[model samples]
Target chain A: MNGSSKKYWTDDPEMVERYVLGRLSEEEKRRLDAEIAECEPCREMLRRETLLAAGVRRFGRDGLRSRLRRRLVRERRSPVRMYQSVGLAAAVVIIAVGVGVYQMFFADLTRPTQFGKKEIVITQGGEIGEAREEKREVRTPEEKMDAPPPEAKPAVRSGAERNVRPAEAAKRTAPEPIQEFAPAAKSDAAAARSIWLLGTVVMETGAARTGAAALSAESRTADAAAPQASPDRPVTLRRGDVRNDVALRQRPLSALPTARRSQMGSARRVETLVETTGDGGLQLTIYTDDVAASELDAASVETLDGDSLVVTTATQRILYRLPPDLFTAPSVRTKR
Target chain B: MAARLFFLTPDAEILDLIRSGDEEGLVMLYSANERMVRVFVTNNSGTPDDAEDLLQEAVIILWERVRAGTFERNAKLSTFIYATVRNLWRARLRGMKREVPADLAERDDASDEPSPADALAGSEMAAAVAAALDRLGEPCRTLLLLYYWEERSMEEIAAQLKFANADTAKSKKYQCKKALERILTDERII
Candidate 1:
């Protein structure tokens, strides 16, 4: 075969094509195949064309596969519907079982932590700008004692809000501090809630104006601090000729609405809002209104039902029980 | 109603399975696309036998490509099969009609019948030969493929490629084969 190929092989490129395609006669194909088995160049040319032809074939068939696949799927859908429904039901059941098992075996047992809520009201003429929050535990007592206080962050204060306390009415009015505290996540991972306040904090426990600085119906008293803004309305005075007649026409105690009294009761009973005012005072405005009830932390919500003045200061929080009527007077005064 | 096999499997994995000589993969392909190929051939002046032959030949070509790892990754398998079956069927139609294919779908503008090379319609080489063929190029590559791969006559080649005559086609083939050898020699492809 080699001898035959050698004799006729001179410049015979077409022979490679013919041999590959099997156009060669029986004798020629046999001889060429034998020669190709031995000859490297002949072998390589044959292989390349074969692959190229194969690639061309693959290209032509490309469009048909996807279309036919769709057809096959369409044809089979009616028969598969029953099985599909069964499978879907099985999947739902499995998910339910999994959830039940997890609840039975992996549920956590710890009770949810409770926070004492306080309402800090800055009463500067009776314009009550109340701020409420329960906890701000960034520094341990030891750490707070060791460190100089950090530079204060920005807070928003309204003209009325800033002047709620007569002591720091000089504070510049600015936007209230936008402290976005994320709702405590339900996850097991516990992290510190960061607090940034610009004004004085008045921890408002429902009780205010209960001490010697407060007034009776027949007397005038004063203590103009945050946690209460003096009223913006003009005074309607009614002084009686009787001795001890600082006679302010008192709104009959019956005039206090039942709901307001309850709300005020809860507001005074439990601490709700803890606002900071000028000189960083703890401002508390405890609200027992249904609206405020929704916001008071669990601990302070309970505390609101009691008449107590909880003063949250830079050092610590102090709870003082007092009569709910302390806030009933239109205006209160600090002893001269 | 049978679940369609191809839909259940992705295209890439189908190629991988076919390359691995999985019978299920080939059956999935046949189940999905055989009707289309049959419809195509019967519409194009081909008999049932002709359609069967064309499809079987397409399958053989697919098997060869997958085995050789020559199939393009991005190209769709169905289109490649369609093109192959179509090309092969056209030649078969030409064979059936000594003068010209009567069906419009099967008809081509070529004025003449294929020469002797048409006899070598379908074939594959040993892996070694294909590897060596990789080294040859140009007029040689096309010449070698047409004469050997497609098995067209020198007359058909002269017409298709616009060579002067059968002799020109013949001489071109000779030079190309020698060039093929030279390429293989330089690369030590043997």
Candidate 2:
């Protein structure tokens, strides 16, 4: 040790601490020990350091130990840690349920899914319709004309619709009952002639579709006009392209994109299928193929015609006619 | 591996708080770690007031260590805090001439359930040494704690205490040790 700093070994208490606390390097420790063995004063200092070092170490150890215990607890109680675990579990369950609902129920409501549903519903409707057609098949034009209109039957009627004039009432006030169209002639040549019954529709969408179009037009006009412009702004269709400009001038139903958009906006998806069989007697079957995302609220069939006569909602329509020979066949006459 | 606390604040913030001597940090540290400290003190023959006083002193000691770069950052704050309180309470009990638990004399062997050991002839010297430490100014007290008690390196002490270099830190440490000895000699406790 340096002679100048040698007395401070005992004079400076922390020097004795270095020796007492064993903080010195191995060489220093060996040197300090040899000095302590020879120097009576240094040995006395070592005894004092031994006592102090033990106390200080105890204090340091206890302080450090307590801090560790508290840290463990804080770690366990940390909200972020707990929430992460909980949130992941909850998210998984929610996603599972959502996917299940989409596949089981919501998926079926979509346009594509409704196609299958509509096909089934259309089959059911066709069965009911075919039943009605069978009843029609048995009756001759003469007997049909003699009977009252089916709409007049109290059991088969409902709503203001029942009293509404039939669509073709103007053409047939007396209703010749198909004698003019397909007479049940006794002549074989007459029986063989192709008979057609022009299918007539009961107008349902005429007011609704037109109203929707007007609303859409009004909305467009209101939206396009400036804030300072008058509320009575007339709707103006922008002719952005040559085709649209020509279409607007023509004033056709396909005048503008808005016109087509309005038509499709109010329309729901639909499909129809028809199957004909010649077993026993001429039989025709028809059913809907695709229905809208919602319920199949209405399904109807009439004549040998289509899903509808006048509306773009038909999707597809088919018709079939039976041979006139069926009415006057010799097998039926021989049986009589 | 520790999870972040509220507001996702970093763990190092605790050291900053202690270093800065912020009142809020002290309060938070107390509330956060009080249950462990209070339980240890009261169970070991201390009153609620003793627990509270010891906790306050421990926090001050921790701040001093942190401020002077004497604190072992690797150690958990809770363990350090509670242990400081326990040690202080035991020292105070010895000063009061009360019979300390036999297990309190020896250092803990990690099991926490203290086992009795023979008391040394110099057990009475603890209070005298602690008083001598208290007489040393803030710098000297912290330097000794860092060098002798906390086992911090001279280079670390230089950086933490803003010494010019490790040599200056060593010189300053020798001066502080001299100061401590002077207090012990003047008091005639060592």
- Candidate 2, chain A: TM-score? 0.26
The lDDT, on a scale of 0 to 1, for candidate 2 is: 0.42
Given candidate 1, what's the lDDT at residue A135? 62
Q: TM-scores for chain B, in order?
A: 0.48, 0.52
Q: Which predicted model would earn the best TM-score?
A: 2
Span of 10 residues, lowest total lDDT, candidate 1 chain A: A242-251
- Candidate 2, position B24, lDDT: 46
User: What is the C-alpha DockQ of each candidate?
Assistant: 0.05, 0.09
Model 2 misses residue B97 by how many Å?
Answer: 7.2
Please, what are the lDDT tens digits per residue for candidate 2 over residues A150-234?
A: 3321110100000111222233335322111222222222121222222122233443232222223433233221111111221
- Give candidate 1's error at residue A226 in angstroms: 99
TM-score of candidate 1's chain B against its reference? 0.48
